[model samples]
Target: MTTALPSGLASAGLNAGEQELLDRVGQVARACAERADHYDRTARFPADDFDDLFAAGLNAPTVPREHGGLGLGPLSRDTLTLWLVTKELAKADLSLGRCWEGHANALVLVDALGSAEQKRRWFDGVVTRGEKWVGWSGEPQAPKPGEKRRFGTSVVRDDGAWVVTGTKVFATSATGAQWAILLVDTEGPGGARHAPDGRDSLLMLACDLSDPSVSVDDSWWDPIGMRATVSHLVRFDGTRLPDANVIGAPGAYLREGWQTAFIPHYAASFLGAAEAAYEYALKYVIRQDKVADPYVQHRVGSMAVDVESAYLWLRHVATLWDTGKREEARLAGSRARHVVEHLALRTVDNCVRVCGARSLIRPSPVERILRDLTFYVRHDNDDQVLATIGRALLGQEHDASFYKP
Candidate 1:
C-alpha cells in the first residue's frame, strides 16, 4: 500500500507538474526505505536504489528541459518544491539523498561554469543515459594550526593536455558515479601558490571515472552512518584530459554562489532523516500502549515542533533565494542550516529517549536513522556558520564571507 504525505506537503504552492513529480518521488522513497536496512547492514552501495530512481525517470530533474531534464537545476528559481522533493527522498534513505544532492551540486557547477559544448556533452549523457555524476572536493589532509589549508590535488598543463594528479577523500558515490566534477589546484609543480585570499587557486574539472588512471580506494570509508553512500577515496594518477574538459577557469567554482545555494539542500535532507526517526518513535509508542504517558506525549510534541520549525526555516531560505536576494539568501541559508542541524540532532535524540533501549539495537530503524543523521549533520564549519549569521545580524561585514570564495 502507498503512504500519503501530510495534507499540505504536496499542495503548498506546487504546480500540477511538480505535484505529480512529488507523488512519484514518494513511491521511490518507499522503495528506498524498504532496502535501506539491508544496505546499511552489509555496508554495500545502494545500487538498487539508484536503479529504481532511473526507472522512475527521476535521475536528471536538474538538467535543462531542452536537454531532456526537468530543468529544476539548483540555479532555477523553484527552490521550495525542490526542497520538498529532497526531504521526501531523504526520509526514505539519507545515503541516497546525500548521493542525489551531490549530483545536483555537480549540475549546478556545470550550468554556471561549463562551456556550451561541455554542457551539451555531459547534460545529454545525463538525461539520455541516466548517467550519474558526483562532486569531489574534500582533501585527505588538513593544514596545521596557524596555516591555511592548501589543495592536495593539482592540474598542470602538460604537452597540450591537462594532467591531473591528486587524491580526494570522502568522494560520495565514487563506487558508482560515471563522472566527477572535481576541484583541483591549477598551480602546477614549481608554480606560484594560490592567493592568500583563498579565491584564485582552485579550478573545476570534469574527470571521467572510467579512465585507466582513476582508482577507487574503498579501504577508508567504513563510517558509523551513511555507509551505503560508498563515499570512498578516489585517486587520480596523471589522469589526462583535453582543454575542453575544464568546466570553468580557475576560481570560477567558488564565484558562482553554488556553495551558499547548497546549504538548504543539506538541511532538508537531514530534516527528513529526523522526521523518519520521529515517525518510527511515534509508531512504537502507540504500538506499545505507552502513548498515554504524559512524558512520552510531551517528547513527541517537542519532536513535532522541531520537524515543523526545520521545514519553515528551509522554506524561508528557499523563498529568499528564489526572489534573487542572493546575499540575504546566503545569510539566511547559513542561519537556517544551523537551526535545522541542531533541531534534527535533538529530534533524533528524542526519538531514542522516548523508545528506550529497543531503539538502540540492530534491526531497529530508529538506531540506523540516529547513526545516519548524526554523521550527516557533522558537516564542517558549524562555528563559522554561526559567527557569520551573528555578524550579518550585527551589521558587520567580515573580510570574507563564511563560505569559501
Candidate 2:
C-alpha cells in the first residue's frame, strides 16, 4: 500500500493547474526517494533528482508570472502551497528538499532584490536554460572579540569589476549548481562601503560558479545525516564578477524578508521526516501483526499526536504569512521549528523502538530517513532561538530575525 500524508495535508488552496504541478512534484519526489539511499551512502549529489526537478519546471516556481514562471508569492496563500511542496519533497528525501529550498530561495532573493536586468537574466537561466543555483549565506565568524560579525567573503572593486575572495562553509548542493547567490562583505582591505553613511555595506552578488577561481572542497562534508546534500566548503579566490551581478543595493538581501520567511521550510522538512518515520513504524507494526499489542498502539498514538501538532504549527505559519503578519510569522516559525525539532527526535526514537533492530540496518528506508533527519534538525541555534522567544514574551529587547545577512 502507498503511504499517504497524514489527514488534512492533501490540499493547500491550489487551483487546477497548480494542483497538477504539485502532483508532478509528488511523482518526482517518489523517484528521488527511490535513489535517496544511494546518494546518502556515497555522499554524492543527486544529479538525477535535480534533473527531474528542472525538467518538471519545479526550479522556478517562485519567479514572477511576468518572468514566465509560476509566480508563487512569498506572503500570500501561495505560502501554503510552498510549505506543502517542501514537505512533500522532504518526506521523500531531506537533503533533496534542502537543496531545492536553497535553489528556490535564490530565485526568490533575485526576484525580490535583483535589478530588472538581473531578474531577467537569473530567472531566464533557471526557467529557460534549466540552470541549477544555490544560495550561500554561511560565513566564518570574526576571529577576535569585540569585532562585529560580518560575511567573511570580501568583495572589492577593481577596474569596474568586482573581485571576490573568501570561503563559505556548508555550501549545500554546490556540486551540480551553475550559479550562486552569495552574501559577501563589500568592505575589503581599503574598507570602502558601497553606500554613503557607512550603512548597508554587506553586498549580495549573483556569481557564476564555473569561474576558475571558485573551488568546491568535498573533503569536509562527512556528516552523520543529510549526507546527500553535498554541502561542501566552497572557496572563492580572486573571482571576478561583472557590475551587473550586484543584487540591489548593499544589504538589500537582508532587508527584503527572505530571511524571516524561510524558517517554515525548515519546520516543514523536519515535520516531513518525522511523519515519514511515523508511517514506517505504523506499517511495520501492522506487518508484524503487533497492532493488537497495547504498547505498540500507545507508541503509535504518541507519534500521531506529535505529527498532528507539527502540522498545525506549519499551517499556522502559512496563515500568518498570508495575512501579512511577517514578524509574527517569523516568531511562530521559530517556535514551531524548535518544538518540531524535539518532536522529530522523539518520533524517530519511537519508530526505532517500534520497528526493532532490523530496521536500523542498511537498505531500509527507515534507517536512511532516521539518519537524514538526525542531522537535518540541528539547524539554527535552538538555544538562542528559544531565549529570543522568551525575551519576546517578557517584552524585552529581542530580534525576530533569524539571519542578519
How would you encode candidate 2's per-residue C-alpha lDDT over 245-324 as one tens digit per residue?
88888766545545667777788888878888898898888889888788887888889888878887888888888888
Question: Which segments of candidate 2 are over 4 A away from where they belong?
Answer: 1-6, 12-15, 73-77, 142-151, 187-199, 403-405
lDDT scores of the candidates, listed in order: 0.79, 0.78
The positional error of residue 353 in candidate 1, measured at the CA in angstroms, is: 1.1
Candidate 1 at 142: error in angstroms?
2.8
TM-score of each: 0.91, 0.90
User: Which 10 successive residues of model 2 have the least lDDT summed?
Assistant: 189-198
- The C-alpha local distance difference test score for the whole of candidate 1 amounts to 0.79
In the range 103-190, model 1's lDDT, one tens digit per residue, is 8778877887888898899998888788899888776354547745343677778887888887777789988889998777675421
